[model samples]
Target chain A: MPIIEVRNLSKTFVTKDATVQALKEINFEVEEGDIYGIIGMSGAGKSTLVRCLNYLEVPTQGTVIVEGHDLSKLSGAELRSLRSSIGMIFQGFNLLMQSKVIDNVMFPLLIHKVTKAEAKKKAEQLLDTVGLSDKAQAYPAQLSGGQRQRVAIARALAMDPKILLCDEATSALDPQTTQSILQLLKKINRETGITIVIITHQMSVVREICHNVAIVQSGEIVERGLVEDIFTHPQSRAAKQLVIEGKDPDEFAKEQEAKSKAVPILHESRKIRIVFGTQSSFEPVIANMILTVGVPVNILRASTMDVGGTARGDMILGLPADPASQEKIISYLKERGLAVEEVQ
Target chain B: MTANEINMILTGVWQTVYMTLVSTLFGYVLGLPWGIALTVTAKEGLHPNKVVYRILDIAANIMRSVPFLIMLILVMPLTMLIVGKTYGSTATVVPLVISAAPLIARMVESSLNEVDHGVIEAAQSVGATNFQIVTRVLIGEARVSLVSGATITIGTVLGYSAMAGTIGGGGLGDIAIRYGYYRYQADILWTTVILLVLLVQLFQAIGTLISVRMDKRHI
Candidate 1:
């Protein structure tokens, strides 16, 4: 069973004048150690969805199952325990600014009534993991934004949660910092195998760290699939647009040429999008005779890339446009067991 | 002034200090919890209760609106009932505490309100219970503002106690009123004026220093 299962979750907040449906029958499952992402534009109900996952914003309808326990059914103490079990980090890095870094990291453990020494020792290790061991004594204000967020991540990990929910955790950060933080998140995922659910509007964040993504739009999941599939052949217009918007011109052009066809997973094969430039366009001809071709060529989508360099622009095309064409392209494209979906 | 006059002023100064300190301390004990409740039960607070909030708010406002001297007189029967008589420093202390508690409570409530909501949210996200959040997070967060408000409370009550002089509170203010105003001792009046000014300055400076020091988010 998945570690976190959200089924038909819906929430509507009523003001005096009107009722706003924040989430509409959202559904998904996150396996243990999966870096699941919820990608959306603002007001797409990403916040509401994630908040509902932990009962922070209780769903008006449907059930949220975490570790086989329905969160909606929990009472006062049980609910708090449930929240503590699933750690959360925020874009604002919600550290108590007046609290020292060490105290902030130790906060959750303190809530659970752990011994002071034990909490302190765990906080030290967690802070060290986030690369802020020297900042234990510093207050949030005394540290930089990245440092503050690290503290928040460390604090979120204090209870040794099985799942981590990141709500726009890096939206406020610069790109370089975003990369490093992404690395840290990936490292956390690898080392502890903790299931992570990140909510963001930025697709690059999804591409960089997430293994699976659900694109939320207007209170519903429009598309859901593995990260590589979503990146290579995004089914939804929004998801495909996000992939293009986040990648380089060459990569995007390759996707446009491919027009992101129905690679369809065709049985969950590891897919790679190989973009051919001026230098590598003939590379496929070298492998055609060595591999098997399942069907005759049918163009999925193609476009030109303008990287503005010696490569100038390269024609990018989706090799297999449909279920019928996929097998032919796959056998032909495979070389030395290199199974990839070449876009350009 | 002469040495004898300085000696009198020094003793009166001690009384003034004693009155301010005792009244302020007692006022804080009574007012802090009231202030915290006011902030915690208002519309945006942790546990909002409109009925309780309105009643507490109305009571604080009514008490605050009353002139300190009139309140001292009006509450005299009650004061005597509690303290055995309406004379001397002991009886005066009761009225002084009464005069300042609401004032300090209002000050504390307003100051606490000025604290950023972000801080409260941060505390909440950490799984702090309401009581722990109040004492540990809210109070600790608002400590600097509360200290400044306390300074203002002490300073204002020092001024208020001068009006209490008619009842023979006999602090430095009473000395000023009886010796300077009633007896028309110009030098004594000037001397008391200087002393009050010094006290205000001292309180203001110390308040600012502590406030600045305690405010870690300093920006």
Candidate 2:
């Protein structure tokens, strides 16, 4: 069975002035040892969903079953016990600023009533695993952002949790630091067989480490599948935008608006997007298609990306007005094993 | 100053320090838990309870609203019951604590509130119980702020201990009233004023030093 199963979960936040629906019937499952990612734009309710997975923010409706226990049915003590088994790290790297690094890592073990000596030994080991054993005496404030996150990760792992929840855990760091943290998480998952659920807005994060992904859009799961599939063949508008944009979705939207205004006829013409996997990444398929079809295609946009360590290339081409030429171009691309779909 | 006058001044300093320190200690005994309750019941706090919070809120407000001199006289009977008298430095502690506790409570509440909510959330995510969150996470993280607030509380309590002089509560203020105001001794009055100012400055400097040393966020 999947280690974490979220079945039709919904959460509503009722304030004095207004009731906001933060999550809407979200459903997904993380198998044991899977590096699952939940990706979305800001305010897409991914954070709320991760919190509900651990029962930090109790679901307003439906149930969350983790390791065969329904979180909603558990008592307070039971829930806390379950939470101890589910490790969590946040974007802020919420280490106790007053505590030393070793103490911060030992926090959860101490909370669970482990003896000081044992907790210290375990915290040191975890810090070693994250490659910060030498800096154990330093305070979190004295460390760089990456080092702080490493301390947080060590603290989260102090309980030997089965599942690790990362809520935008690398968002606060620079790109290089984000990469290092992601690598550390990947290493921990590989060595320990710990199931990790990553919640992030950065597509690069999902592409780098996540095995399977769910795209959240406005309190709902718009699409979910293998990371490679979502990146190469995004089914929903949100997924396509996230995959194609790759960085700063809102900025891309604004750029798209500007492009439409600059070239109004570009949208009016028939456009088709073609995706090619690693096998065809080297071949000039688009060029070959134009030469065979004897028609010049207006290349709207083209980019290549590494999806799941394999090079995949995709491009949007404006087809000729003549239906015969369009059909020939589509078939030519299809014959070469390219996934083609008309862009609306 | 004569030997007798200097001796009187020394006693006055001892009385003032004793009343201030003792009152602050007693004040925290009542105020710390009260402040923790206030913070834990606040709207954004760990365990928010409207009823408990409202009661504590109103009580603190009422206690703080009453001026120290009026409260000193108003609680005179209660003071007699606790310390068996309503005069002298020891007796002044009762009213000094009574006045300082609620003010300390307010300060404690605000200091605890200044702790990052994200840290509290992190504690919760790690399965920390509410009590653990308060004592370990909230209290531990807000130590610097709490220490600084205590310094301010001690300073305020010292000032209030002086106000207790109006009711024959012993301290420098009593000497100032009796020797300077009543007997028109300018030299004695100026001496007491200078000592009080120095004591306040000493308290302020110590508090800053402790807070700065305790603060790991900056270093």
Candidate 3:
């Protein structure tokens, strides 16, 4: 069974003047030991969706089943115990400014009624795991942003939780720091077998560590699949936008303009964009089709680059101005397992 | 100065210190919990209750609005009932605590409120109960601010204690009134003023020292 299951989850924020629907009937399941990324732009309810998984933000409708326990039905004491088993970290780090790093790490253990000496020993071990054993006596204000996040991670692991929710955990750090933090999270997951749910607006973050991804837009999951699948074959407009924008802003703009112009002349000839995965880029499929089929083809634009260790290419092809020829070309590409989409 | 006058001034100093410290202790004993309730019941608090917050908020405001001197007179009957008399250092403590408690409560509320909501959420994420969040997270985090607030409360109560002298309350203020204002002893009046200033400085210095020692943010 999936370790975490969310069914038809929806959340609406009601105020005096108006009500805002932050999430809408979101449904997804996370298996054990999966690094799942909920990717979205700001205000896309990505944070809210993750918060619901841990019952931080209760869903307005539907049920959240974490390890087969319905979150909404659990009593306060039961919910608290459940929360202790599921750790969470945040972008702000949120370390107690008044406490030393060691004490901050010990906070969760102490809350679980662990003895002071035992909690302290465990905290020191965890701090050593995060490579901050020497800085245990220092306050959070004295540490760098990266170091503060390390302390937060240590604190989150104090309870030996089965799952960890990361809400923009690296958003406040520099690129180098973000890379290091991602590495630490990956290491922790590998060693502990902890399932991680990452909520972030940065597609690069998802590409760096996520095994699977769900693209959320306007309070709904628009597209979801394995990271490689979504990266190479984005089906929804939102997912395509994220993929293209993640690759290159300049190329995305050019592709968008070509696709808009393609729509007006759809009756004559259809402009098609074919996304080539790393393996297929070496094949001379396009050249072969033109040579064998005796159909004239025009290439408007093309670019290929390595993304997440895989070579991918985006090409805009102009076909002969005939419905019969367009149909044949599209089928031919599809038969070869290339992801082809009409530009318009 | 004569030896007799020096003895009187020393006694007055002790009385002033005793009244100030006693009133402040009692004030906080009552106000600290009151303030926590106010903060926790607030609209944006852990367990928001508009009705409880509104009632407490209004009560605190009403108590605070009353001028200290007028309140001292208004609560004379209650003061008599509590202390069995109404015109000495002990009697003055009753009104001083009554007045300072509300002020201290408001100070405590503001101090606890200054604690970051993100920190509170962090505590909650770790399965901290509501009481744990309040005692350990809210109060523990706000300790520095609370200490500073207590310092200010003590200073204000010291000033109120001086005002108590108008109703035969004992302290340096009473001696200043009797020897300087009534008898026109300018030297005695000046000495009392200087002593009050020195007391305030002493309390301030100690308060700052303690607050800084308690703070872990800088070190």
Candidate 4:
């Protein structure tokens, strides 16, 4: 059975001037022990959707059934208890700046009336799991962003929650720091079998850790599937954009506006994106393809990306103006097990 | 100066110190919770109640708007009921507390409001009760600001305590009035003024030091 199930969930925010529908009929299920990623742009309602899972923001129109309990139907105390069962961490780390790391982690346990000694032991163990046992007495401001996030993770896990919700948890960290945090999360998920629901705008983050992903756009789930599948052959515009940008965000952004002129100018005939999974990445497929086709293909962009920890190579190649050579190259590349799609 | 005059000045110092410290203590006793209520009942607060917030809001505003001297006289009957007199340093405490509580409430509300919203959300996510969020997250996070507000409150209350001298409320203000203004003793007036300044500075320095030390937000 799915651990979390959302059906026809909609959230509408009514202000004085406007009634904004932040989420529209969002539907998805997170299976037990699954790492689910909800990816979107800034205003894509990913945060709102995550908030709905915990009922931090109640949905206006549907049911959220977590662990067989319809969240909206639960009483105040029952809801609170349910909330305690699900841990959440944020992009900002949201730690108590005044409290020591140990104290921050112990906060939820103490709130649940756990004995100080017992809570302390548990907090210490969690800190060890997150690799911050030595920094127990350190204040949050004294730690770096990555360290602070680890403390937050320790605190979230203090309750031994069945599910962990991460809302852009690594957006604030640098690339290396982001990788370390993601690795820590992956480790925790594996060891504890704790289901994790990650909400992020960065497709790279999803590709790095999530097994399944749902792409949100303007309060709707535009596309969703296995991370590898989406990376290889994105069917939706939102998914395709995210996939393309996931390779090089800065260049992709420039490419968006410049796409109208740059594509035609750069290549007179045709351009195709070839995505190679880990198996095909090791072979010199491109080199062999050039020799086999007997025509030089312009490498518009080539980079190897991390797709769920496995290296996947993606390249945008400009095919020759001659139709026969373009067809031959396309057919040859298809025969090699590379996922190819024409780039407009 | 005669030994008798010096002794009287010393008594005045004692009276002023007694009133200031006592009034500040009572002020926080009433103000801290009052401020918390104002904050928690606010529109964006934990258990936002428009009715409770408005009542508290209006009451605090009214108490703060009335000038301290008028409040001293205005609460004279209440003070007479509470302390059986409206003139001594102890009786002056009644009106001083009345005035200080509301101002402290405003300060406390502001301090608690300054706490990051994200921190409160984190606390709520962990299923902390509203009361727990108020006492632990909001109050704990705003401790530095609360201390700083208390310091400022102490200084303001001390100044108000001196103003009580206009009536029969006793303190250095009383001494300065009787000897300095009534008898035209410039030295006594300057001495009382200097002592009051020193006292204010002393409280301020101590408060600042405590606040700075308590602030863990910085390195």
Model 2 has fnat of: 0.79
lDDT of 1: 0.78
- Among all candidates shown, the one with the greatest DockQ: 2
For chain B alone, what TM-score does every candidate structure achieve against the true structure?
0.93, 0.98, 0.97, 0.98
Q: Which candidate, 1 or 2, would have the higher DockQ against the true structure?
A: 2
lDDT of 1 by residue, A1-344 (tens): 99999999989999889999988989999999999999888888998898887776779999999999988777767777767778888888877766788988888898679999999999999999999999898888888788888998998888888888998999899988888898999899999999999998877687678878999988999999887656556667677557646543334546667866646554432223433446446455425622555444433334443221122122223443466456555554454233244322
Q: Clashing pairs in model 1?
A: A257-A301, A257-A302, A257-A303, A258-A318, A294-A328
Scored by lDDT, model 3 comes in at: 0.89
DockQ of the candidate models in sequence: 0.30, 0.87, 0.69, 0.82
> lDDT by residue for model 4 over B15-103, one digit each (tens)?
88898888888988998899999999998898899999999999999999999999999999999999998888999999999999999
Worst 10 residues of 2 chain A by lDDT: A260-269
Best by TM-score: 2
How well does candidate 2 score on lDDT at residue B135?
84
Which is the winner by TM-score between candidate 1 and candidate 3? 3
DockQ of 4: 0.82
For model 2, what is the alpha-carbon lDDT of residue A242? Answer: 84
Q: In order, what are the TM-scores of chain A for the candidates?
A: 0.76, 0.93, 0.83, 0.94
Worst 10 residues of 4 chain A by lDDT: A245-254
Candidate 2 deviant stretches above 4 angstroms: A256-268, A282-284, A298-301
Per-residue lDDT of candidate 2, residues A193-284 (tens digit) = 99999999999899889999999999999999999877767889998888766775666678888986884653467988888887886888
Candidate 4 ranges with C-alpha deviation above 4 Å: A247-255, A258-267, A281-284, A287-293
- Mind giving the per-residue lDDT tens digits that candidate 3 earns over B1-219? 678887888888889999999999999999998999999999889899999999889989999999999998999999999999999899999999999999999999999999998899889888999999998899889999999999999999999998998887888898889888898988888888899999999999999999999898775
